[model samples]
Target: MSCVKLLNDFPFTFSREATYQVCEKVETRCSFLDKLGIHLAGIWICECSCGSSDLPLDHLRSDKGWSLPNRLCPCRGPLSILKKQLCSWSEYYEWRGISLDSPVALLLHWPLTMYQAIQLAFGKQLTNETTDELCIHYLGPERELYQTAVFGELHALLPGVRVHIDFVGPEVPHDRDGETISLSSYAHCMEANCSCKTPISTDDSSKITLRFHSGYYHDCYEELTKEFLPDLIIAPNAGIAAYKSWLPTIELIREIEVPTIFSDYCEEACHLAANCITSVTGTPLAIPVQLNPFRHPLAVEDSALLLPCYSNCFLFGI
Candidate 1:
């Protein structure tokens, strides 16, 4: 492939039907590996939670990259190409030494190592120090087991005054922590940030919401090294904000592990709002998305491959 072929394309397209058609025609030793996952086709790399466009594909999927792909991104996350092969952006093991086995811890970075940060989790030895490590350093951890802490805690005190979590866009600078949001901004797009995008009812879970999504939009090239592959990664708060139009709450939390679910349910809503795209740099909110480089580089192009779980480099919904 030529560098020119991998530069930039606004609306990146894939031959999903054609790819699938061809997939159906052939059979490999690992039929599952060769049977392209339906969601992997025709993705826009830019929608990735990270702040990078494709690394010329040469850097990411080159012959050399394929030889020692683990060196590509130390954080054990997913790859855009893998999504096409495996149903989830994760499942890196299928590709051999190309993905982060420790997806959740991979998202966190040093100064507060991902491993150390995760040590202070809900089920583990969660203490004021541990909670402080996560709350102060990462804002919120992105492990699926901690969904209650990340998504729950919504307690509406009165009518029209419900609790809710949201992504107010990237407005601040990088903090090496979790995504930061502007409550006022979320209030303005109230409907856009709902759990199911529906208003709170008496028993609505979101009535008591938690807003720990996208923060700053940047990449992990600076931190990740061949010598020291990150065991964890930060979130991709900014990039997700860049695609705010096509984003929502559930996708915010579960996009990586459950891309089809997010795409099937939230993609339409987010795509519809694309017309009013807002520049994240100009906003008053920002959060750092720690991800495992084991995942793909931060997605900045229009085509992106959401991970099966933390393996996807991103800040939850960002």
Candidate 2:
């Protein structure tokens, strides 16, 4: 389907026809991977009072209750019936023989109020601590729907890449039991195995190091640049702002020369507002005009502005 037609027919809310169409497009895309002998795995996402949580939607229903509103989330927030909207693709893919797995990443393309977006973009310029609070707020309960939608589309486009979601906090241990630990411990806490050593597969025979870094640390950006050295960085814009001050993460990113994509769901006004950030920080900005056919209805196609360090790198919204 043409991206224009898909965008026109995009479903903002749940409906049988819309859900089926979206899932059908996903299945068609999965066929591409099948032709390459790549196994398809799906990630199902849903949110509850506990925060953004993931489990197979089918598993949730079978174990908890078929009726969603009555189901009790582990955090004790009654699961909303709307949570089911995020699962249509998973069900459709599984019916078509795709292997469904626990979500590898937590999507963060949450809709932002004009007031909130302005505060976030400008707030970090004023104070560092407020940026951290804003980052946490951006990831709060309200973000579930948009995050789920964009993530679903991203899964459809690159079904072969294994994605994992994690959260990092500010507290740095001077030493582990008084001895310093390597920075990889900060990026991935588990010592036995680390996904950082692995590379995300690309269809073109290129490998990209994708890292989702979230936290309110004074030196997190410096540590990540030194240790992670990711090819691409996908971070919540608000989180970036929160960690931006004192050390100026944006400047650090520019110095390290990695392509970064910031996600915030607002209309044209938001794009203009984000441009203000790019202008002040000296980051080159590009706005994607065409929606990727696989993008979700809630995916802000024209609104997401990409900030890159150089001309060779362009934001490929996934």
Candidate 3:
């Protein structure tokens, strides 16, 4: 299937109610899933700004946000990674209504994974205290450009702190190269009476600001860091081993030592990237390969391999 078809079939902007209505009737009796019908795996449900606060893992897993068979033969393999998440869904979701199966949580995974990587590398220095503003340099953003508004979840996930993300990559649209978007409020539901629609008083507001730079990170590094340096750098599903362009970027990251982290679609990719980084920069990973708790809950289409693959399933640091 074409990538555009996948994007259209699974609109990430749908409201939570609308998403549930679409997936509620899907039967879970089948033991195997066909590629054509796997679009449900990509379903996204943007829960109202606040789905009534957080709930326990047991409750979250028990509820249904999307459909899946009782025993899908393919899921028993790599897809089982979802059941072995590194952190509880509560770490990523502050709401009770969204299920662990929902891909609505996927877009927010970028920020949540950044939060986890920060905690892993810097301990509590950045996140424990609310006084310090955190700046992040995010690399290689494509589809995420369309999902920018969903990133407002970062404000709720990291309360009382200011976050500035500079999205630097060649895929960034030329027209928006230097445009900056400031998010002052959470993404709200379609319902007019949603309580989250209540405007925040000036005294209680915090902003998550994002800027776009259209080019390779290394090519734009000098200008991007001229004013302020990032506390951390993140690249999601970065095919480091596949691209020779990553060599110079890897060297640059080593020189700066800014606690950069990357995630891949699978363990093999993470391992390959780890080796590439070690060979180029003569430096080993600061954070070893491990599963990402906030990874997307759907399987990606891959005909060349027998093992299942999902976006951002594994993470490592350099």
lDDT of each: 0.24, 0.28, 0.59
Candidate 1 Cα misplacement greater than 4 A, ranges:
1-35, 40-129, 132-166, 170-209, 212-292, 297-318
* Cα lDDT over the full model 1: 0.24
- Per residue, candidate 3 scores C-alpha lDDT tens digits across 17-92 of 2223222323221211232233323222212112212322222111122233322111111211122223645533
lDDT string for model 1 (203-280, tens) is: 432133323333421222222222222222333222232453333432322322211101111222233322222232
Highest TM-score, which number? Answer: 3
Pick the lDDT winner.
Answer: 3
RMSD list, candidates in order: 19.8, 16.6, 12.2
The alpha-carbon deviation from the true structure for residue 42 of candidate 3, after best TM-score superposition, in angstroms, is: 14
Q: List, residue by residue over 1-318, the lDDT tens digit for candidate 2.
A: 222333334223322222343234443323322332222222122322222333322321111211111111011111121212132333323322323221111121221121222222343222222221111111112233212222222222222332222223332112211121111101111123433223223342111122233444234555444543343444332322233341354555556554444443322323453554565556545434122222223222122233111111112211
| Candidate 3 Cα deviation (angstroms), residue 19 | 18
Off by over 4 Å in 3: 1-86, 90-103, 125-131, 202-205
Task: Tell me the TM-score of each prediction against the true structure.
Answer: 0.20, 0.36, 0.70
Clash pairs (backbone) in predicted model 3: none
